[model samples]
Target chain A: MADVPSMEALEALLRRLPGIGPRSAQRICYDLLVRKRNLLPQLATALERAHAAVRFCERCNNLSEAPLCAVCKGLHRDHSLLCIVESPADLRAIEDTGMFSGDYFVLMGHLSPLDGVGPEALHLDRLSERLAEADLQEVIFATNPTLEGEATAQFLADLVPAGITISRIAHGVPVGGELEYVDRGTLGRALHGRRLLDE
Target chain B: MADVPSMEALEALLRRLPGIGPRSAQRICYDLLVRKRNLLPQLATALERAHAAVRFCERCNNLSEAPLCAVCKGLHRDHSLLCIVESPADLRAIEDTGMFSGDYFVLMGHLSPLDGVGPEALHLDRLSERLAEADLQEVIFATNPTLEGEATAQFLADLVPAGITISRIAHGVPVGGELEYVDRGTLGRALHGRRLLDE
Candidate 1:
């Protein structure tokens, strides 16, 4: 195996991918080399194409081929409402729901000082510029409910101008999730955030 | 997301890899595009390099940059003994033990009629040729103990010349495994194939 440098290099690179372990990396290496040989060129071409073409949206920081992402350019979406999320995947998750027809601001990542991710790293200036320029009446913090996400949301929330309303997405037990199976933190949050039912 | 065809293409290609699902594919896409942008070119280069340089050992069907794999070219290994395995990963696993100083033949895959894999796909012809050419005294079937693997080993065992001793690797409780936790089938096999202890 040591004699096969190319295969080793390929396995090492695959191992660097998120969630892929050593065994999985080797499996992928073998899969590319043997079972899915045809996928090699296609994957390589896709990587090249992505590197050559994909760029962050100038307005929202979401991945886009053009200066503005599809959501940013769409006329049907509400310009007065904005949703700030940690990543493009989150933005897409929100978009998939068909709820929130508002514009978006992708932070790309949350505040993690230990990992060296700070406000500057998150493009806070760009977010501020968008907030100042856009006639946004409300901004929704759709970051995950984790500590870092909450801290990031709080940091961004404080940055919003005086007039605009700011709110965080609720933290509660997920719909269709069993109460008994829910974690303690979530159950606590769900109970604390409970609303009064109107007859 | 659809507007970014390159990203979409990259995600689609990543999704096709074994064990990667839709969400995982998107996560990997984001990881490559955002977090690990530098890895893109390196991964692409690795894929290109592997595709261009990696070739199977003409003798053993193991992946190799050269015509013959290191094991096949080694001067110290017992050329009289050959171990048959299902994949390169299995071959490496056996090699990792620092035991079995023998040559090898990689079957690449087991017979799976449901998926259309058969004898020809496993390259039994090359195995036959190697068997005929090499002065092998014993052939060990190190194929997985699964149904298809057993069938493949049995099929290949039938092809070995009359004089060469044929054997399948033992299947029972693993070396460090507790007997209580072992599955019924494996325990049954262990009981059925129990060996007599010599004083």
Candidate 2:
């Protein structure tokens, strides 16, 4: 059945979200419009609040309400170690592990030649300046292991000035993965990077 | 990384929607905040518009901006046939099939004793009044084929006054479903309602 104009507009906007298809969008629109009372107002208010408050971090380009992101502003986080990631979601994923205590630099996206997105588009010049200003001892490239991500990492590696250490996150079999189930490339990497127990 | 308060609030509201889990809600939040420029304003406007315009139809209880829903206001549709459904979504689903050209009555919900819902909660009194006023030839119970739906249908059948035909939608294996894959209840129903080839 055809939805009313406003419902149709809401559904259209919802469909633009990642992972939301036509059916789900329609359901969401109907839920907001009718099923759940007072939901639309809440959602609208939240959206407006976020739009008014959230902004990009001045240093890391991560999402923030203030000039600097929480990670950048936190006193205990390691300023000497910066983790470069493709998006804030990736940074959050790493943070969820509770293993990393370093600051971050969010690239927002990876370089893709087909999309005409290159170093200039990614603001590599600003990244270079940020690296020069910070007292960073190590920079970790935590971009996805996709081809475009690898190329972006390679480009950043080439751009690193002399003396400061640069590292890429290891690509190997998962911690609990069986060798038989792991892809050949990952298995090969795991074997190639094997270390002595004594060492 | 912890999201800012406004972003977190937006994500929370978004998660309340059907089919949106935490991950997709986060992605949608990020898309609205960063990926798509000016998305939040459009979504907010659409939501506000829908909230302001959409209202329950006075006659059939379906969503509409005006007093009467499109179906109730239509002159050409069968005024003598009224289909009763559990929700507006159900009404929309039936309309999409292009099979029924009758007016509708939305129950909004079925009788759930555990949830404190009953015939009164579903406005069965108003339904009786409407039925009395209309020159109805038939009343189709199009509620879902669940236990509660069945109970609700039964209650309505009992409520329907004499001299009016009452009907229920058939329940059996889905049109393209294989008998082997179909559930036992549906198979049983299909068998019980089997029709003659020439009839």
Candidate 3:
């Protein structure tokens, strides 16, 4: 099997992907080479096209084919309201909800000092520039409710001017989640953040 | 995100791979485009190179970079003893054991009537031709122990000429397996195939 250089090379590349172990890489390689032969060229072409075209949006840092992403370029979105998230995947999740019609700034990652990630790595300079330049009225922190995310949010909040309103997305039990199954940390947050309801 | 044609195309192509769902595809796409941007061209080149170089072995139907696979071209292996397997993965598994220095004929897939695979799909014509042309003394069925694998082995056994020894790999409790945990069917087979030990 090692004699097949091309196969081994492809398998090694596949192993580099997130969540792909050696066995899984081998299975995927076999499936592509044998079961779905047509996909080989299609995937290759797709990779090349994406490599050439896809880039970070100049305004929001989301994935874009051009300088500005759809949200950044769109006329209808509320530019005054900005939601900061960790990644494009998080932005996509917020977009899929259809509840928010505002601009987004993707951090690309959180502030993790242990793993060597910091404000510079997250492009906080660009974020601060946008905050200073844009006439934003409110900025919502939609980062994950983790220690690093909270630290990043607090760090970004300090950089914003005093006039703008700053807020964090609520931490509570998920809509369809069971209270019995909820962890103590989430339960505590839900209890602490409980809001009064109108009769 | 919809405006990013290349990104969507790459994600769609990735989704076609085995075990990749929509969310996983998006995650992988982002990981490639943003996190490991260097992997994009590398993976594309690997795919193109593998597609151009890899093809079925003319003799054994295994994946090969040339007309004949390494095993088929090797002089040290026993050509008179042929081991039949379902796919290149199975052949690789056997090869990893450092045992069975014999020639192999890869069926590529087992007979699946529901899925439209038959003797023709398994390339029985080539198998029969090899059986007739080669002065083989023994043939080992190394196919999986599943129902389809067993049927395929039995079907191929009938094609072998008389006086040629035919054998199936033993099914029994695995080396580290406990009797309490062994499945009933395997336990039954193990009992039935029990051999006499010399005192």
Candidate 4:
């Protein structure tokens, strides 16, 4: 069914967002009209500017406005250790932890041969080139513990040099989640990678 | 604890919504930075513009940019047989049904002595003035079924001339809502006012 104009366009725009449906879009549009008008333009500008200005970092494939993202350009991050992730969101997840001081190489997408996405489509060429030039001592394969992600990690392991150490992030019961709810596969993998804590 | 740059302000801006919470706001900000940067300015503009540009429709107190809203100024709608409603959303809800062809007179607030909202605050004087001059035949009291709404309806009923017929939209189980899920109070009212359909 065709919606009435003005609200129809705004509603369509809102529906394209992650969780918003048509009803929600309509409510959001009406709420916007009820509350804020001038701020709407600033929001619009930010949207256009951020989309147009942003690009994957040339070196690491993390999102950025410049040639390299903040993490890739930062002086403090260790170049010897590289954290590999699937997307910019994944990199942000790693950044939130604040436990790792190493630099990142965001893949932007995982290798999925079935979907016709191969090594060429991802930032694999840059990974190998970076491996050759940089004094990269270790590569931490922190891709999510999904089937595709595991296959991608295995595929990349074959491409990198033999000397550089490669490790995956701990696959275990989540810190706050109950053990009863944890899946058997994850529990088994966690048992396989058990480590002795100094504490 | 105090948030830096008032994350709470950002959080409040995001969380003032019906279902959004602090965590959801956090997620939304990240999501916006990630994928929805293109639409953020429009969102902000909608918010600011809605606040700055919109005002109460001088005739009905419905949200509008002009002294009189598009609904009030439209040449097509029946001007005399006014549909009295609780608020702007209520007006829109009636409009959405596509059953009502008459014009509207919105009561900005209902009568609530406990909350200190009274007849004077509700713009009843304006409504009364309009009633005196209006060539009105009927006034549909489309206020909510709540206690305050009933009280407001009673107050309006007192002021309305003896010649004008007053009516209310039937209430009951909503189109998709289960009778079991419907409040006993609302269900009773709906059944009491149920019409005998030809079908």
- List RMSD in Å for every model shown: 2.0, 1.8, 2.3, 4.9
- Model 2 Cα lDDT, one tens digit per residue, A1-199: 3437777888898888899999999888777766785998888888888999999999888889889888888889887888899987788889889999988888989999999997877778778886885588888999999999999999898877788899999888898878789999888988898878998
For model 2, residues B1-199, the per-residue Cα lDDT tens digits are 4649899998888889999999989888877777885989888888989999888999888888788888888878987888999998888889889899988999999999989997788988789887886578899999999999999999889878789999999988898878899989889999998889998
Pitting candidate 2 against candidate 4, the one with the higher DockQ is: 2
Question: Residue pairs in steric clash, candidate 2?
Answer: none
Native contact recovery (fnat) for each candidate is: 0.87, 0.75, 0.78, 0.17
Which 10-residue window of candidate 3 chain A scores lowest in summed lDDT? A126-135
Misplaced by over 4 Å in model 2 are A1-3, A176-181, A197-199, B1-3
lDDT of 3 by residue, A1-199 (tens): 8568999999999988887889989989888887888889889999999999999999888999989999898889988888999998899899999999988999999999999987888888888887885668999999999999999999889988889999999999999999999999999999999998962
DockQ agreement of candidate 3 with the native complex: 0.76
Error of 2 at B174 (Å): 0.7
The docking quality of candidate 4, as DockQ, is: 0.24
Off by over 4 Å in 4: A1-4, A48-58, A63-70, A73-76, A113-116, A133-135, A179-199, B1-81, B108-126, B133-135, B146-148, B183-199
Predictions ranked by DockQ, top down? 1, 3, 2, 4
The 0-to-1 C-alpha lDDT of every candidate, in the order given, reads 0.90, 0.86, 0.90, 0.73
Listing candidates in order, what is each one's chain A TM-score?
0.93, 0.91, 0.93, 0.91
Q: Rank the candidates by TM-score, best first.
A: 2, 1, 3, 4
Q: How do the predictions measure up, each by TM-score?
A: 0.93, 0.95, 0.92, 0.75
Model 1: lDDT of residue B184: 100
Candidate 4's TM-score: 0.75
Worst 10 residues of 2 chain A by lDDT: A1-10
Listed models, DockQ each: 0.84, 0.69, 0.76, 0.24
